[model samples]
Target: MNLFADMRAVVISALDQMVADGALPEGLDFANVAVEPPRDAAHGDMATNAAMVLAKPAKLKPRDIADALASKLMDDARVALADVAGPGFLNLRLETGVWAGVVQAALEQGSGFGRSDMGAGRKVNVEYVSANPTGPLHVGHTRGAVFGDALASLLDYAGYDVTREYYINDGGAQVDVLARSVYLRYLEAHGQEVAFEDGTYPGDYLVAVGEALKDKVGDAYVDTGEQVWLEEVRDFSTDAMMDLIRADLAALGVEMDVFYSEKSLYGTGQIEAAIADLKGKDLIYRGTLEPPKGKVPEDWEPREQMLFRSTAHGDDVDRPIQKSDGAWTYFAPDIAYHYDKISRGFDELIDVFGADHGGYVKRMKAAVSALSDGRVPVDIKLTQLVRLFKDCAPFKMSKRAGTFVTLRDVVDLVGSDVTRFVMLTRKQDAPLDFDFTKVLEQSKDNPVFYVQYAHARVCSVLRKAQAEGWDMSDAALAQVDVSGNTHEAELKLAAKLAEWPRLVEIAARTNEPHRIAFYLYELAGELHALWNRGNELPELRFMQDTAEASAPKIALARATAIVISAGLGILGVAPAEEMR
Candidate 1:
């Protein structure tokens, strides 16, 4: 159960009583009224702005409303103290029984302690790592992959019907270049020396694709023209590249429920159908174009083109769906792709694009809005660049990816766990620096290691307890009475655990999964701090002179581990039972 939500309900009940007694006006909106942790712990356990928010609206004074509300709340046994602060902010200190119940709740709930029903089973499509199927996914794609996968997992934890998806960019001219690159490698595999031109992919990863192509075709397309082999080789090369991409993603703990093909939209009339749908809404138009702002193109000229009226939905300018040459622009396929998602009955769509795609966000949102007639909401999250560091210097590029560090290289160096956790330590829109120097360190400086260490410490406590012939299972710990264990050290940790359910809803609502990583780190810190306190205070320890007496203390430790495991599960990271 959410302690904050429960307290908010108590505050709302008090306000309703005031309205009933004619002390406050009726029909005041409580939607903006919030009950949350007090800014200063010294103030109280929780605070609410119910009085201040309703004072002006109710035509009443702040102090008068706050006093009446506080008096009404004092009748509840759960509320130990309720007093008005500076204005009408109600600062409340809950009874110690309330905090103890949180530990009991965590033990009873196990890893599902913080799972929320905030999403209410809404279907959400999360598309990420939609790199061109020409080669391996690189470091930039790795960040997007981790962010998107973790976000999908987070939303699922918050009760969303989430789908992890990847879009393959095989419908564009880039795939033709990949075909030519594989042809050159195919020629090399046949003992004919071939040089990679400036536009060709020369990464060693393609060598195997070329050899496999030669094995299947066996000189059938060796001396053929472009028309005869372009389609076939492009298909072959894209399949192989996707196979490699899947392996790379698998190594990093990423698995997509859907691998959508851009090519599937090309010949299936899906692109035309989506455009036609928009055309029916009067969103499509043929209009003269203006040159872009600042530096204009050298060949800038006014041309009538098919455009989507994106400006109506908040885009800076109308986006062209078709070019002067009559070929569909890159934006056309994305519109069709999102339209297809809407047709599949997804309530929400989230695109996890690299930071370079920031400029496309408004247009994409506009397309989804027009396609769904504003019935659906689309959120585009941009993952910023990850600058890698090793040996106190910037990391070098990968030979496998030719121009960047491949995802496999990072996973191979530190394993998938470190790579994933470090990738999410920062906000998705903020740049992150992944330093081998810092991440691998076994100290509080390394967030992943620090959090894992806290979990491992709890496991060690349980093992010690079990070895002493004391049962430490969740059921046994959950049965213990936590009211007697009242050290500030223990209660502080319990307070942090109480924030979990509230934090989950906040993160899910904001579509930010990094908040989970950050929260886990703070929770781990509180746990570690409590552990440190035990060294100075003998009674504060998990194990005491008597096994039965120490059960309540052990319950607290186990509850902390339960929440840690639940949080790590959401981030797609494994909780370490023991540190290596």
Candidate 2:
């Protein structure tokens, strides 16, 4: 059903024939040979660099190889035209029936039209929104949550066995601070006034956690110091905070396959095992790290520590795994976590980190490389900051989360669909402005609305056709003669639809889900363009003068909806049937 892939197969088969005829060398590498859509749509349906790529290896001139390739390609009925463009680039135009077949394929496939087997069912763990378990998730985590969830779903569509995961940051000092903050609230719940200080959380979200703690133990910890209750309170508060985080994620329709506790790596010999493995490979050693390259920390001092030879893998410098005080550094637990992932037999690991964690990327990648002996590749995707705006003014901080807007706050303002779609309108590593005013507008400027409207428009066509007593089932459309849809605008839309499978493979290979959103927007635009064209040309409308003529046009519109629904499904957005 993938016309592009089919055409590439055609190109490859033709090249094999060329080798048989001795027009090209037998052993020339065809790995670099590619058939993709021409940059300019006017050029042709697809453009291949087969000639340009093999010319040097075949010891032939560019034009000479291209001419031979073109003749071989034109021998097939599907290749309507194959012209040699500049520098031996071969642009191909397919027969109109090819596009008609694509429209029928989409109807037959429904939402599965563009699904790919690019990943070949490889196990991939996508860990994201591992925000500290000290508070509810905030705006930064919102982008990460959306991006990770979408990417996981995208990989699934591309035939990867995806596991959505979250790494709970409960083993860090932040949770200790959360414990102290909750203790103050517990006192307040007992009618004793307390102030939230510099080293504690002050968000009102913890007020209920404190009350719940008092309900559980009554007055047991009322007269005790940190020694008697620090661990108990830390565990209790972390559970409450994790509950809050889960609810926040649920509000946005995200569910995780695993909630990996960082605390689980502590005192369990997991950290020791991971580091010991590295040590056995001569990767771990006690050494002194060099001073900061630029501005050193105010508390920076040279100290002998346990270091990992991360530079050997690809990092700029070796990284510390343990400090002189015998405490494992933050990177140590992360290494253990990834080692656990590799041990679990995942073929790949993908971590969705906030932009602030950019500095940790190379070292983490190096650790995974060393841990799996380069067998497992870890792809770290950094989601940039999200700036929220309302009515042209910056959105205020949430009273619940204290200093920043919480995920619940964003989800509540605009429903989860809008929030998720708007978050993906920009690349994960680029800053996004989520303007409440702009996103809700019913215009082309709002991509979620525009794309959803396209799906709804197709539904409208279905409803009207049904009301006219015309059979509008996909099977009926599939049986019709859609080759009659040779209109230039109709052909253009089918051309775009043909790119869906190609785009899915590219996005999955690159681990970028935003590309799906961008593609959907472009497809929706093309659908809207054809809809607009129908205003002046009655024959171009989906509702033609006769049911026989209308079936083919309806087939095209339904096909567009099918792809949009599939794309939106990958993005975790519910395709709209009717715009409310």
lDDT (C-alpha, whole model) for all candidates: 0.91, 0.92
Instruction: State TM-scores per candidate.
Output: 0.98, 0.98
Q: How far is candidate 1 from the true structure (C-alpha RMSD, Å)?
A: 1.1
Give the per-residue lDDT digits (tens) of candidate 2, residues 31-122.
Answer: 88898989999999999999888888888999999999999999999999999988898999999999988998998887788898889999
**Least lDDT summed over 10 consecutive residues: which range in candidate 1?**
395-404
User: Which stretches in model 1 have alpha-carbon errors above 4 Å?
Assistant: none
Model 1: per-residue lDDT, tens digit, 369-443?
999999999999999999988866987755567767899988998989889999999999999999987899998
Clashes of 1: 0
Return the top candidate by lDDT.
2
Looking at candidate 2, what is the lDDT of residue 104?
A: 89
lDDT of candidate 2 vs native?
Answer: 0.92
Error of 2 at 303 (Å): 2.1
